[model samples]
Target: MSGCHDCADCPAAKFPPPPAKAAHVIAIVGPPNSGKSTLFNRLTGLHQKVANFPGVTVEHHVGRLRADTDREVLLVDLPGVYSLLPHSEDERVTHDVLTGLRPGMEPEAVLLILDCTNLGRHLLLAAPILNLKLPTLVILNMADDLRNRGGQVDVAKLSAELGAPVALISASSGEGVDKVYQFIQGTAAGRAKVKAPLIQLPVLQDIPKCRRWASEVGAGAAYRAPEPPRWTRRLDAVFLHPWAGPLIFLAVVILVFQSIFAWATPVMDGMKTLVEASGAWVAPHIPTPLLRSLVVDGVWSGVGSVLVFLPQILLLFFFIGILEDSGYLARAALIADRTMRKFGLQGKSFIPLLSAYACAVPAVMSARTIENKRDRIATIMIAPLMTCSARLPVYTLIIAAFLPNRPLLGPILGTQAAALLGLYVLGFLAAVLTARLLKSSILKSGGTPFVLEMPPYRWPTLRSISLRLVDRARVFLRKAGTVILVVALLLWVAAHLPLQNGKPPEIGQSFAGQIGHAMEPVIKPLGFDWKIGIGLLTSLAARETIVATLGTIYGMEGEAASHGLQQALHADLTPGGALALLIFFAFAMQCMSTLAIVRRETGGWRWPAAQFAYMGLLAYAGAFLANQLAGGAVTRLIAFLQ
Candidate 1:
């Protein structure tokens, strides 16, 4: 009866067994930039899932820990709170969860993370938490920072005064982490309890007596006359300069994007070739045409489409990680705050908007950092306009095939690269316009004042960066994997069905072709053919799937251009057609995964459905105009030349 039971039915016995000790729910709480997330990551590794607390937009990260021989604990990384009194949705969720007032959950232990150097201010939240009487532990994180500053904490003495154990842990370096884990298990299992001095409470505020205890315990832990690092001061001068900071940030962003394209070209080419070779290798071995098409056209093309963007995505994250680690991101946020306020957005929304350029999934998720509901929703709505990497293949292919390589402003930049840059600018402008429009009309609200904590610059650890890269890649592959696989197979079937007189049917006669033909008139004015129409249809599965859809529809085996696929497309598609296709891809709601996530985030299908409808209309209208303009221009130029 005392042991854990796997079954639901307890033999209808005389006495109900005492409830097994409830598993301890430890909440990790601290201020922003206090290494709380880092500690959570180190403890949980990859065993964490992100979800929103019920009825709230705030994200909740939950992970399990095997603390001791037989004890399992659930660790919750609560949103960083500056105080116990909630000022934002994130803080409210944290507060509710801690007080057991959330819809249906309660934490049994609170792990208050305090920065060793800033303990005076960080202990404000800890004082209130101790009053909850939920068995607390004080984790003096960044202990190494104290030592670096010519200071040290007397942990044993600190524990004696605080009425609880104090562990001097360096979350980043894993110093003293095991001891903290051991203490958690020991306390949860009731094997040992430290009875240190308690801070007497004043009946009014329910303040715990632990303040005095902590003060006594931490008396020698305090130090004075710590020298500031010269390099940090020098770096901050240039990085946080009011006049030149914004300009430098912009230049850095442009350089990163340029590098993404330039550096990833060779790797992307190699992937394309590999995919093609893989298709060829598997083709002869597969017996059925259906199976062959499924493997070569569906699976290879779909996976390849996702892989092509890997380089750009990784590059974006690389720069993001560096900026985040170097503490430049917070400064950037500060610089952008005034500008963002005009559009009813917080400065924190800037990163998410920037990230949307790579993909909207992370961008939308990143919106959690934006505290206000209005800002978060407005940010989400405009995220798709940020030119995600899924649109890159379409943009590059069109530019290569139709746009001349000649430079517009002399020889410094190619016309194609210029156009690519224009597209990025266009996406940014569209997002800005859309956000403003939404704010003024549908989601009007005051912007949240930005008060971001700017941490000191630090050398980014390779281990952390590597882990983030792997985590992002794994997430991308997983989300795009199954959906891509099924869609690919369906596309192949659509493009290769109904053999006619022992001859493999031409695309025009295949199922996809017929469907495209049926919708031709609807899109004909925009210069798209039935094949392009079919590609657009399959794109609903995922925006990147458009490339694979085209590959399959063109009777190509894999992700790469076949012997004549590009040439054939160029010959068949007028300049207007290319422009129209590019415009469509730029604006269309083509990612199903994005829609699903939006639904989950917004708590209903209403917003997502509206998003799809409005975006679809915008795509069609934009593409129509682009086609007319580009087609007329091409015709006039050709005539003049003749």
Candidate 2:
């Protein structure tokens, strides 16, 4: 009989035949800044999920790996730990998972990833992990850096000394990654044997025997120091300076924002033309008025509204990847910490806040890294106020139509750019105030001490950055696409219902119109017509839906202009009305998806409901104040000129 068939005759096989395939659970562990996350991303590609552990705010990232023809491996990325003996909440998570003591899971094997250049220090944690008696593999990542520093490693000798499979890998370049996969496959097939490495820890006087063992095992595997990169040191000089660093960071941010509009203008204009042409094409062929309205007003308007901002979104993510990959993001956080702290936030909060500029869902999810309950909650609460890219469509439409193009003082501050800057400032102010209010009231509690590891600056791989950008774009298209589509259909149905006298009722007399008219008594004081009121209501599903809702309300012919929605609004709306609309969008909590994510993250409806309530009231108050002040000021200016 074949060796694989032996189990068929055994008593254990009475119920059913056991499959020959073996499943291995591999946990990847490393110290902070050791490229553990980069390795995880490389191995998993896009197949991963982030879940919360029971009763804790920590995130658990799990991905599946098919390492061989017969075996499937489950890869778990544990939080980075400084030592096996935990000192913080996140570190405890790592400790528990490694020891198979974590609440709901146990790993069958462990992959210990270490930075090659810092092997001596990394071995401190490796010693304790080895004592668990689990099958283990050691990966010396960043081998490229080691080789570039004129340092070399003898892999065969190192493996023999360490008593574990050892592989030298450059995670970013995918070098030596295949060897890791091969080793895992062999181990899962029961064809590979690894003895527990003897670890000698001279520094740990409390465990002399363990120390001696680690020393003997690590001797040949370790290498002498290599020269540090001169460019890293030179860049650090300017990037880490207390006074000059923040200024440089602000300048970079300004340039990135400016480039978003400047670089994406051509693509955006082309998309606008294409959308208008498509609308014109559909209008003539469709005979039924209702069907025609749905196609032109609902699908065309809504999808077109969101797609027009694709260029801006892509450009924003492109720069975000560059900053994150180049390691400037951490330095920016360090420099902004003092200012952020004054508002009851830590330096690490900058990551989530900055992420919110792309979208708030990921920003809230990223807040799990904040250990303190109070800080995490406060960060989640304020993240949505950070002017996400979705707001750009509304802002672009308003500013282009209403804001003058004249230069102020110099070319540096054109009136158009200045108005955009003012909106961002308002968003920042809103986030700061919201954070402060939450800290003192509902979320009043002390936060854990912030201790972040700053990684050395390195050149980000172009391939990796491009891949990440594409991944983010896909995610946006998937999640936001569905929500926008449904909301658009609903808006179309609402605005087109209750046909009167065999002709489709105008928007002012339809179902959405009646609702808006009923609410007009309240919103009219803010200078909003019923049409604008309807736009605000639909926008609650997603902020960008306002543009689509407006396009639909104005009818098909109006939406087909070269200037598109902006020109339509300029011809249709008075300056005071435009100002009121901008203010409304600026402060509104206009995304239900963000609310649902908050509920999931916070584990209750209380926080999300409260967030919606407060933001809605704030939006109304801000819009009312702006309309009154702006309208009165314009009237007085006109009288003065006359």
lDDT per model vs. reference: 0.71, 0.73
Superposed on all Cα atoms, the candidates' RMSDs to the truth, in angstroms, are 6.2, 7.6
Pick by TM-score: which candidate is best? Answer: 1
For residues 407-477, what per-residue lDDT tens digits would candidate 2 score against the true structure? Answer: 77597887677778888899889989999998888777645466666667888877767766665555455
Q: In model 1, how many backbone clashes occur?
A: 5
Error of 2 at 118 (Å): 1.4
TM-score of each: 0.81, 0.76
RMSD of 1: 6.2
lDDT of 1: 0.71
Model 2 gets an lDDT of 0.73
| Superposition TM-score, candidate 1 onto the true structure | 0.81
Q: Pairs clashing in candidate 1?
A: 161-213, 198-209, 199-209, 199-210, 200-209
**Lowest lDDT 10-mer window, candidate 1?**
6-15
